[model samples]
Target: MQTVAFTQMKDGTTEEYQFLRSLEHRYIRSLPERLEGALQSLGSGLQGYQISRLEHSLQAATRAEADGADIDYIVAALLHDLGDELAPANHSQFAASILRPYVRAEVTWVVEMHGLFQMRYYAHHYGDNPDGYLAYQDHPWFVACCHFCERWDQAAFDPSYPTKPLAYFMPMLREVFSRTAFDPAILQAP
Candidate 1:
């Protein structure tokens, strides 16, 4: 296992930085497996729902795929709730972080904002304004996010929906997560 010689960033030579970058590159290659483990852990159920969190995620992905959504959309649907275990209040942002590097800005924005859009379904039942989503009614991706919640996330609690297993999505996960950390298409100057 090669390592950087410096203990602090300011002390590093180019050689040490290259070594660290190599290590990071190798580590990133295994991200799909790591994400899968995180998804599997959702089966433990922190707060109960009509279905386990893992099932809800699978159903969402399955729905997205069935609806003829592109691969990025399906993958986003699968990971949209990944942050619930660590940041339930801001899970959409957490999930969006994982997507931002690999996907289109629109896809990332949809993932980032789906939590608020989802609230429209039942927020009023808990005394929160269900129309809170109206705050973003004019944003470009607003309709896409609303459709995501309407067609996939909110409707995914069913236990007998014939949701695909996690293994079925492994290839897509690997392909999506294997991209370079920064996309040249998005980052390069026009």
Candidate 2:
């Protein structure tokens, strides 16, 4: 069917719902391309940094790869700041939600909390509590989030870092996003 017959969700027939589901699955398969476009847009995002947001992201992923992190961590590093443009106020959570259905729980938790953990680097200068992340210190993934910020997210701003280009990460991004959505095996706690 070209379009659903129903104008509202409550009126959708079984066949129409199935058709919509097929369409959605096709759209889902294209996520990596959409994400590539989004990352490209970040080239013009928030200024003042020596590098573009895209560069920061590329650098973060490059560091993750160099450190021998698994695909989930590398992809997480690449996308950790994707919401910086549209959800600057809660970018971390926004990015995490995008990744929640694909990556491990620990990765999602770290990405969700990276913004708070990152405060330790600059919040004190703004009179905000740098120790804000201390509240989660006892959580299982607290150290992982701390390392995410300290080693990748917070440290990826250098203009001179030899970061891999976006093309270099496309395959990895495609691999991760192509995972069966919300697969229990993939999302299970690490």
Candidate 3:
């Protein structure tokens, strides 16, 4: 395919713009594969947990699937910790950003705020407030986020858990990411 020749966006012609957009569409289609690769890499960093980060993530998704979560929710659970390697300080927000355009706002919100919700489980060990999540208690999705963290995220680290392999989720991941981002026809939070 012919490529855009402009060094800057302002100089691009209409044809070039269309070309770039097509390229972007193609690249977006590969998001699921990219996410799977990222999940695989999670095993390389941080070691305090009983299982690898990849394992924890798979277990979380496994549990979510077992609980009959929708594809978007299960995929969200699978990729929720993907940002840990790149943005440990704000991993939840990073993951949420990735999911925001593809999933429901509530799912994105849950992913975004799960880190704080998860703190309720063991934050006291680090001298942090266990009830810090209470700050968001009145939000409509608070209960859902609480369930996500309590039932899936926080409880997914068991070594003996029957976590499905990453390959098991690839098809669902691809389907979730295949959605038209920010589609006006779909319901989403403003």
Candidate 4:
């Protein structure tokens, strides 16, 4: 039970401390410290911290864990965009493949839904036609994530919250890494 308490995030003004808690507490403990470490080293969920998909994933994971979702669901939320931070352009499928070994269909669905969700939201909000939106419904994960996103997005920070540009985020990844797991050491390795 390595309880790590973290300070409030970049978008927040308040100083708060709460231990990182997960729903499948027992399983995570035995999975290897590297799992959490790998997740922690991941930083802002994408290569550039400013992108913020990963930070959002952490927030979403924290929310899901507290809500008592299953382990697969918990990891899915935590790693929903695990590949996003790496290849922002082609990450959805990459993330799914990366996680295939460690998780199950439930989590995989969420990962797959991310693209559909973003596509549909962009089209519905901007484009007049729903040609792209219609395709999203065909993805079962899209439906599940839509419902889940609705619940947690309320607490998600603004995309530009840290008041810094995307380029600056890469440098600040140390800050991102440090806060995620409440340990600065994870930022040491490549």
Q: Which stretches of candidate 3 lie over 4 Å from their true place?
A: none
What does candidate 3's lDDT look like per residue over 98-139, in tens digits?
988888888999999999999988999999899989999999
Q: Which should have the higher TM-score, number 1 or number 4?
A: 1
Report the candidate with higher lDDT, 1 versus 4: 1
Q: What are the TM-scores, per candidate, against the unseen true structure?
A: 0.93, 0.97, 0.95, 0.50
Predicted structure 4: lDDT: 0.51
Specify the poorest-scoring 10-residue window by lDDT in model 1: 181-190
Error of 3 at 167 (Å): 0.7
Task: Give the Cα lDDT of each candidate.
Answer: 0.90, 0.95, 0.91, 0.51
Q: Which pairs clash (backbone N, Cα, C closer than 3 Å) in model 4?
A: 45-54, 45-85, 46-85, 47-85
Q: After superposition, how far is residue 179 of candidate 3 from its true place, in Å?
A: 0.6
lDDT of 2 by residue, 1-190 (tens): 8998888899989999999999999999999999999999999999999999999999999999998999999999999999999999999999999999999999999999999999999998999899989998899999899888999988999998999999999999999999998899999966
* Top-lDDT candidate index: 2
The clash numbers for all candidates, in the given order, read 0, 0, 0, 4
* lDDT, candidate 1, 40-107, per-residue tens: 99998676687899999999999999999988899999999999999988999999999888888888
Query: How does candidate 3 fare on TM-score?
Result: 0.95
Steric clash pairs (candidate 1): none
